[model samples]
Target: MNRSERRACRRLRVAGAGVAALLALSACSSSDSDSSAQLDSPASASAPDKLSGITVFAAASLKETFTTLGEQFEKEHPDTKVTFSFGGSDALAASITGGAPADVFASASPKTMKVVTDGGAAYGAPATFARNELEIATLPDNPDKIASLKDLTKSDLKVVLCDRAAPCGSATEKALDTARLKLTPASYEEDAKTALTKVVLKEADAAVVYKTDVKAAGDKVEGVDFPESAVAISGYPIALLKKSQNTVAAEAFIALVQSPAGQKILSRAGFLKP
Candidate 1:
């Protein structure tokens, strides 16, 4: 073959080899791109579901109000199921300290909340959400003619008071002390709600409880306002627990309680906003 032809033949061969290599590289790249795309695509999106279940420990005085609030909250957040245990603030605090599986706690007094905070059992700062003032709860008919705080100290009134250990009881003590009166109650209840219950069931002629509690009791009891009650308002504080298994749910619940809707609900239930 001629030299030029030989040179041309070599060039053609080199160009043909280059085209084959390029084709092979393009095929490998296509395969890799397909594999990468598959890896990059998201698996699936999950629909938000209700938190399995959350346990809330709240003060006894919050029974009706919190129960109603819980029902409303559940309706608003279908993904969350709220359960509650309502008792004296001291008892609830003790339960939390005893390692009870509570996701949230609503206390009737800062003193009870202090117990939780001091023990390092709370997850965050407790927020005061509501205020409650003391009131004289009497039988539906007010048969005793009890008119004011001074009436409570009458030798024949037959009154029931919460134990001083309870928030309501302590607040009652403070109010009475502020008014310079000493009362000899027929019985000292373990909690305010219990004292009110005593009056409702005709076990006592009168009792001291939160204004909200009397309202919650409806016509079953008659509420008598005393000027001294203004001095012993109880602030309600709520907090999430540090060891809550449902931290996210607990936080969501707390947020709801602090929201305008929550406040409205509480207000409708006779709770004074903080």
Candidate 2:
């Protein structure tokens, strides 16, 4: 089997006792047949993680890096299953406020996290785990010769930007304002990924998206760095929800995100330390 499948089978094996605990807490785990395959092994035989399943709601910009971190966390805590829900930070915050069941919420910006914290959906002080900034994502060849913030304002260039409600969009606006340049894009998307996708798909000539999104796109597009982006750096904050079913597991997941290993994964994905 491949690595991920082996890890999954290992998780199932390690989840012998966890299956019993999970059933007692909530009926949201593996099937009976899977659980029947293994009886409780001695704790000394193989020490498994205390947590069984951890669901996290994270910002869209965190998808690639968080997935890597989540898998690493599950490896460390073999009994735990980490599931993620990634979207615009604002949308995820709205869902949390609307009572969607989630253990952790990792927002792209502190302002979005405040939405849940203000509504009493979060339990403790949120930690700023990482930072990100905007960049110009253009076609592979960048035929238009787009270089800086001002280059986007060229009348012929078709540009896409994230909606102002999202962190990336707000950051883009700040950078534009910092450079004293005004831009009107062809369209406004919901998140940085969507904005970057427009450029990747050739639907738009360029887009203002997170540096991470541009990096995640790999050779699908090219990233253009500009000085004004420094004016709008966004802080990523993570917190445990107040209504979590397994507080211990949720807290442990948050701790891993702030750990050195997690930081390394994020840094490799073009994220900056908070």
Candidate 3:
């Protein structure tokens, strides 16, 4: 009776041990499979690093040109993505000064670039890539017959000009002062492009804006060259930001903008190369 009972108890204990070992191994196998699955998944395998994304804050007038350049830059650097926030140069400068995470800053004027440089937001000395002059833009039909700067002084003409806070506005003021003409615009726009838009939309009879902006408007408006515009020339500046995380990419993009291809794009868009 003692031998049979002892043997049966030992056999039962051995069988229980085997089952426990199998269960442990099965759990380990399940965990390994899960890890393998995770590694093989497309999302985990192709996830991009945060540094691959770059943000640029540029002037509103550069919207078309920079957008084209951004697309080309992304194509050249497949792993990196370029994003932009285009606005008035003053506003863009203000954002960078206020600690916005911008990798690059391309301004429509040196005056605005100085705002960022003064704040120590630029990584290097800004480079002038292009020059622009002010033009009197009107509707395609020129219904109000805005022909020259002096015509802007007409009380009946609804003229639009950039705000005094913006580079275009400041340039306009300088040009007016040079021409000895005083203009009280119907509205002081936030940016050159906005002022141009007002005239293009037929909301205003005329606006003082960049020649590049007038060209950008295509058939929406007709541009009229004025002698006073010679007094004020806006210089476009490009620079890398000090707080940029992707310095390599930022430098590469800056180089691209200075390249011949970039110059062609800018030229075709009506920007005068410096």
Candidate 4:
């Protein structure tokens, strides 16, 4: 099915599922089974009663889906509130390690999560939650007649890329290297959203960004599939921070994201199964 069809079908299914067990899902790198099968309720079986709140630091690519997850989390645990800080996963990891007030960390790449895991900022080994791949996002129409990774090398094409420092940028580099192609970008964006925004805003002709970002952008952008994307897939990982004040609520939130409900929501957003 296409995007609209999938979204419509999900709405009908959610309408019937009720509010107490709200969540979403998407694709990624986990070897674990869908956790939602056993933890479908608003609160996990081990969740505490009347918890105050939980704060999550996640990748910018996860903003849309995680927002949905946050809302569903609040509904499931009415006593709890979910607040999020979304940006480049690497930056978010930096903030977490710098003593940012956050309960959980969800990163777009394992390399960024390593910044925390290596620093012993995380409570334990982070679990691979999902995976994402890069796609060429361009203006709604094929104005540039852009086709493959090689097409991006056109000197006349104004290409935007995520900075090599970010996960999306790193993935873009991998894809480019796989194709044995390199083209200078007009500008290097700080994050995937900004890179995509350039295409939507008509400031750039094309951008290499996360597939999920293009999916979230909807009609604002058009996505081009290329073979090299499979070679540079990004893995998403999530874990509780050592400074967590409410581990019960925090754990419940991560559990919900890893649950089937979370997976379905994420799948709708174009994220790959773990």
User: Which candidate achieves the best TM-score against the true structure?
Assistant: 4
For candidate 2, give the lDDT of residue 186: 100
- For model 4, residues 1-274, the per-residue Cα lDDT tens digits are 9999999999988886755344332232231345654343323433345458988999999999999999999999899899999998888888888888788999999999999999878877899879999999989977888889999999899999998989999999999998999789999998999999999999999999999999999999889999999999999999988767677899989999999999999999999999
List residue ranges in candidate 1 displaced over 4 A: 1-51
Residue lDDT tens for model 3, 226-266: 89888798899999887677766877888888999999999
Return the TM-score for candidate 1, rounded to 2 decimals: 0.80
TM-scores for every predicted model: 0.80, 0.81, 0.81, 0.81
> For model 2, what is the C-alpha lDDT against the true structure?
0.88
Pairs of residues at least 3 apart in sequence or in different chains that clash in candidate 2: none
| Alpha-carbon runs more than 4 Å astray in model 3 | 1-50
Question: Clash totals for all models, in order?
Answer: 2, 0, 0, 23
Query: lDDT per model, in order?
Result: 0.86, 0.88, 0.87, 0.88
lDDT of 4: 0.88
